[model samples]
Target chain A: MKSVMIVGVGGQGTLLASRVLGRVMLDAGYDVKVSEVHGMSQRGGSVVTYVRWGDKVESPVINEGEADVLLAFEQLEAARFLPYLKKDGVVVTNTQQIDPMPVITGAAVYPEKLIEKLEEKGVRLTALDALSLAKEAGSQKAVNVVLIGAMASSLDIPEALWIEAIEKTVPPKFLEMNKRAFELGFHA
Target chain B: MKELLQGNEAVARGLYEAGVTVVSSYPGTPSTEITEAAAMYDEIYCEWAPNEKVAAEVAAGAAIGGARSFCGMKHVGLNVAADPVFTMSYIGVNGGMVIGVADDPGMHSSQNEQDSRNYAIAAKLLMLEPSDSAECRDMTKLAFELSEQFDTPVMLRLSTRIAHSRSIVDTVDRVDVPLRPYVKNAAKNVMLPAFARPKHEMVEARTVKEREWAEICALNFVEDNGSATGVIVAGSVYKYAKEALGDTVNYLKLGVVNPLPVEKIRNFANGLDKVYVIEELDDILETHCRKIGVEVIGKDLFPRCGEFSQKLIAEKMGVARDESVSIEESIPVRPPVMCCGCPHRGLFYALKREGVYVSGDIGCYTLGASAPLGAMDACICMGASISALHGYNKARGAEAEKKAVAVIGDSTFMHSGVTSLIDIAYNRSNSTVIILDNSITGMTGHQQNPTTGLTIKGDPTSAVDLEALCRAIGIQDVQVVDPYDLKATRAALKAALTAECPSVIISRRPCALLKTVKHKPALTVDTDKCIGCKACMGIGCPAISMKDGKAVIDATQCVGCGVCTDLCPKKAIG
Candidate 1:
């Protein structure tokens, strides 16, 4: 089983990542089940989407120390969800930070040196300047895709599967850029 | 093949697959999308009622007329519909009607984190909570089936996480589960005391029978682990239990939460060395276990409030709380606030300055009750401000009437404020009501509402004219003020509050955060002529701040509506 958890703030396209992963797994001939934490997602709150795929999948939630990949769209949120990964799991994350409600309200502070801490724990980590990369891709909002692209190497799923998933998930007008974004994620 | 869909869309698909013919709901987060999704299907007759109660009644009426029906709202919506819901429990149903009330455990878009589970118990209806999109769909389909089977309404409970999240739902072919033909029975449908007394007896009997039925039903299942320790949990939290306990603990995962399968639970707990009842927010399950002579760890072990994660579950279960998982320390918190170019900012600033007792309602305007603007004195629930304002005036008389103003949102006013406005007009409380028409349900991710002339699925719908509605309610003093036009908004607010009769001021502006609305160029301060009076800071625009003895605006962040232009008394800034 290859389990992936994507963590990001609300409106960060975390859902799209899961869909793309699910499609990729299905294309690879594996059974895939994707789940998500919804509701307050659009409120700029901490949001996570889970995708579990294998020859056959039973549950959507990845058990503790069982996630094969952790794709994080924000630094603090990645730190917040770091526990989902296995001891030897790889983490691909955006170096950019979008503070959650608690941070802006003075109730908490954004954890600095998060990637350093993750690296120290012997977790295979790749940090990309996702916001800048998304800007380079002509949409700063595509940061989620930038982080998703960084995780493409491990997927081993066909490019077509990713395309189909992106096509199904995004609205029709946004399809082309999202395909390019998927390619970016796949190539990253 | 599973298709990608939004949480709301899947629930709609679930209803469609289940063959629901009638759908009615008032817009709300986590729940709004369900009806919106259902509306897209021509087979389903969907409408947005003025309030939860009306929506519930309409669904109940459809069920009475022999159609499987559904109504959805946020948790607070249940309170508004409780009267009908409780009565419907006694009356039962003809066609199955599933009522969805999504609870925001962390108060994500609500004023309070009240669990809808308690309402299920209070109303004596079957309640099922879906843990994810699949269950959100599956349980919704099942809810309709169970509702008809039990001759009762079923509550399809959802949380913020389940309602808004996307998941892959493998749906079955659409089932044409229509209601049997309706035949009105005066003895049953009409609840005179004599008729109601027998119906009440039937209600109690039905609950007992439902519990017995739940024990054998597929909804409540015992997942045996060959372990002595057993855990009973339901809804989304059930996923947490499954994740944290692994192969060590057995579980009695109940899908139908109401009329809980006590015998089956006791049977499952009989041989266990320890029992734990895990749930989010409340101890309804824990209380049931304790009442039925089963000892279990719940609220006392885990915190009573907020959502839970797998790590929290492991810690409470006395196991390693993810020893391999490392969290970054010293992370800063960022509380949600109104967006930088928010239209409500200046209006709230004026309210705060005037020191008025503002009874706030739900929406982005709720952010005004937070720090800086801190204008609103109270926020009880949706559409509460108008009624609360009336009560305040009645209690405190002239002084209260002079200082207090009821602040509500355009969408919220359309949702439930209309009735309260009617009340104010009928009684002539002389209370000032301000409808902050940001042209969207801003709190719940800017879903369109009646005033926005848009449907939840982005289709064009009839726009409810607030001024016309006020006029219809017989309020002569109705004015529209652009909230971004601070002088006009302030003047209108002042004038309305001073009027001898009940009046309404519509603070008209599209929400700044709305993607459809383009923002003006970011305002810049001429540093050469800048004198830092910090007057612009009074409005609490996040983009404008005092830096190095001069008023500075972050160009990258600001959506320049020129709001701060008037704030600088010295005329040195902007």
Candidate 2:
């Protein structure tokens, strides 16, 4: 059984990324269960999605301490979801920072040195400027695909399967750019 | 073929497979996608009714006319439609009718974490609950059959996790089931005193037979792993228990929640060393176990609060979860906020400046209650703003009228706010109602409403004219303002607030997320001349942030509505 947790702020394209991952696992003949957060939470709030696959999966929830991999799309969200990661779990995080409401309202501060702090904890962290890589591929919206490409480096799935999954999951109009984004992040 | 489908989507597939002819629903979180998915199929007729009550009545009328009909709504939506639902329980159906209600146990997008299963019992309706997408599909199809076999309407209960989660489901072709002939039987349909009295007896008799059938149904079967710890669970909680304890604990898994099998649960609890009734939000099942003289460890061990998870279940049972690590640091919470360049911002900013008590309704504009642009006061449910504002004024007399105003979205105004507004006029209160017309249903992913000038399928339709409707409702004072135009909006709000008679201020602007709406280029800050007084942050736009004592705006997030530009004291924002 394998569990992957995708954490990001709302409207950051995490839902589409989970769909691509779900497609990949389903095509691999594994029973896949993916949980999503929708409605009110999608309005610039912290959002988490769970993707699990096995011979037969029971629960769609990936609770605290159960996630094998944490794919984070922002610095603060990455640090916030660290508790969900297993002891030896690997983290693929994008270095982009989006201020939450409290920080904007001067009620709190955005924590600094998140990547350095996580690395100092003896955690295996793969950090990248996914937003920049996505920009190189033509749009910053492809940041999700770029992170997926980076996360693929630690995953055992074939490169061909990842591409196939992207093909099936992404819309035709933006397919070429997302593929470019994936390639750039995969090699970075 | 097996495909991963969300539980709500699977319910639509089941509706299609069951040959449902009419499906009506009002857009609510978790339950909205069911009708949206059903609309994808060409055979079924789907619609976005004005409100849950109208939706239920539509479904009930279709069923009475001999068509398999279904209505879907969030738990609170059931409260709106319960008037018709309770009577439909006795009136029965000519064909088959099913109601799909999804509860928000953790109040994810809902005002309350109400247990919808209670509605099933109170309404005397048979209820089926599914844990995953596959069961969502199967139970929906079975619900229709069970409804027809018992001559009653069936309710399918789902929680947030079950409604929103994706799980693999085996696909099957739609079955061809012709509708039953519509027979004229007023004795059963009409709810007159004499006729309804007989139907009430039939309902009691029906419950008895359904309870008997519940005892041996395959859906209530037990999985005895011969373990001493027995857990009686249902819906998503059952799946979480399985994931946490696996086969270490014996399980009495139930799919039929209402008209619960007492004898089956008693037998399952008899041999176990410990019995735990684990349910989310409420002790509906636990209370049932005790009524039948069964000793079960429930609510005492499991707090009747938020959603239960695998880790919580494991910890409660003295089982250990996998080890995890995190750096010790406090993180700021990220609550949902209004999108950048939201139309509601201008009106809310104006209301905040005026310091008026803004009675609010359910919608994206409810985020007006959030900090910075905090404007709204009360938000109970759909259309509660108008009526509540009227009552507030009537309670305090005319002084409260100018101090308070009701604000509702265009979609919500059409949903139930129209009647709420009518109450203010008919009762002759000096209340001012502001209709935030974003031109679409902004909350539940932009489903078209009666005010949207489009159908659920995006077909052209007649849109409601707010100004004309207000005139017809005997309100002579109707002011329209562009929410993007701060000056105009504030002026209009002032006029309505001071009006001698009841009046309305319509703040009109399309939602920023709508594709048809064009945005100006992202604004830049003239940091060289900026004082960073933080005046622009008053609107709470996510795009603007501070760096090195200067305001900076991210191009990716800024829609350049220039609401912030209007706020900069030094004119630093462009």
Candidate 3:
């Protein structure tokens, strides 16, 4: 079984990213289970979604130190959830910083050098300014696609399959922008 | 065709395939999507009732009128709908009726962590719990069939894990089911003491027969893995045990949780070296095992409060996870808060400034109790704010009345707060209630309600007039104020607090996240005029933060509500 973890702040389109991942895995004729948090937690809170695929998936959750790939949509979330990644796991992170409530309230300061810190931990890391790439792709909301593109490159999945999954998952109006965003991160 | 479906979505699909014609539900987290998904099917008639009680009664009425019907709500909502459910137990359904109740063990989106299984046993309703989305679909169809076959209403229990999780589900065509003709039998349909006496006898007889069914039902089965030790479990907890223990332990998975089989469980435990019963929240299963004269281990190793994870189960059961290495640094936490330009922000800010004891209700407004705002004193449940506020003031007299207020959302005010407000008026206890009318249900992902002037299907409907309703119920000092206008909101709140009679101030503004509501360009801060003083942080808006001793607003999140603009002493934010 391969376990993938998607971590980000709420309202960052992580749900859409998980849906695309679910689509790709299902198309490969693998049993898949995707778990998500909804309602109150989605209101500007730190949120995590799990996507697991195998011959027969048992649990929908990915426990601590069990994830094969950790996809972070923001820098702070990546550092906070690093423990979920395995010793030999791959990290695909967007170097975008959105200060959580404690930071904004001056109760705590936001940490610095997160990507560098993760890289220093001796893990295979793919880091990028996904927000800027997504903006260049015509919509900042496409950051999820950008990170998915970076994570896709690490896995043995084909680019055509990812594109096909994106095409099937995203709405018609945002498909063009997401495709460009995916390409930018794929080659980054 | 095989498609991925959330458990809630699969239940909706099952409702469609079961030939259900009536569906009524009130929106509650983890359970709202079931009715929302069911409404898409034209063959089914769906509506959002005002409360879970109304929804249950509507479903029961439909069932009694000879149509398959269903209603879904959260666990606490089951308490509100329990009156009908218990009675529906005595008055057996003419057509099948199913109730879907989602329990939040960790209180993810709920105010309390309540288990809904006890409600099934108390109501004498047969309940089936599914572990995955595929079973969510399968058991739902089976629930409708069992409701008919057993001549009783069936309850389908779900939790946050199962309801929100998506898994592979094979779709099937709708099966043709002929509706049973309604027969006028006063003794069975009416539940007065005279008619209910005979029905009471029927319920006892039905339980004995159902126990026989539980013994050999396919939904409750054993998987022999040739292991000495075994685990007995149900619902989503089964998945955790399966992943943690694997084939090292034998399994007895029960889909029908209520009225657990006695002989089957005893047989499964006879040869096992150790028998462990794994359940979340309560020890209902463990208690049942002891009653059936079966020795099992549960609740001793498991905490009775919250959820269970695969890691926790593995640790307790003497299993080991991979010895993995990763980062161990701690970071700041991100809590749910009022969104940027949230309509509730200004009202909560003004209330916080007044230093009043604000009784809060559930919704996005409940976030008022958190963070820098920290305005609300107590928040119990959906409509507790108004009623609890009245009791609070009555207990403390005029001293507390002048220093307290109840803040509720528009949808919540419609749900059950109306009667609470009336209690204050009739009893002549002075109380101030502020209805945060954001024109829609801001929580549970924006479901349409009576106050929204729309139906579940987005059709126009008769909207409830809050002002007129208050006046008709003898509230003289009724006022409306836009929460965006801070000065006016404060004035209205002040006037109501000092008023002699029970007063109501409607804080009217549409939710910023509403699609029809457009946001202006993000406000910019002039650094030259900006002072180091942090006056704008009091609202706790997620968009505003300090950068180099200056207030900075993220343009992406800022909706330009300008509530912070009024707080700036230096005229820095505009």
Query: DockQ of candidates 1 onward, in order?
Result: 0.35, 0.87, 0.77
Clashes of each: 23, 0, 0
- Model 3: residues with Cα > 4 Å off, grouped in runs: B326-328
- On DockQ, the candidate that comes out on top is 2
The total of clashing pairs for model 3 equals 0
TM-score of chain A of each: 0.90, 0.98, 0.97
User: What is the lDDT for B196 in model 1?
Assistant: 96
- Give native contacts recovered, as a fraction, per prediction: 0.36, 0.88, 0.75
Clashing residue pairs found in predicted model 2 = none
lDDT to native, each model: 0.79, 0.92, 0.91
TM-score of each: 0.88, 0.99, 0.99
Ranking 1 against 3 by TM-score, winner: 3
lDDT of 1 by residue, B1-574 (tens): 5765556777899899989998888877768888877988888888777788999999999888889999989888899999999999888788888999888876666768888899999899999877777788888888887888888999988887667655567767888874688897987788899999999888899898888888898878888989989888887677777767787999998888898877898899997898888888888999988999999887889887887766678878878743467764755543456677888888898898889999988877777877667898989888889999999999999878989999998878877788899999999789999988888777756566677777555678778777888999889999998877888888888898889999999888888877788988888888877777667877766566665678777664578877788777766555
Error of 3 at B107 (Å): 1.5
lDDT string for model 2 (A1-188, tens) is 99999999999999998988998999999999999999999999999999999998988988778888899999899899898888888888999999998898888999989999999977789999999999999998899999989988888889999999999988899999999999988887
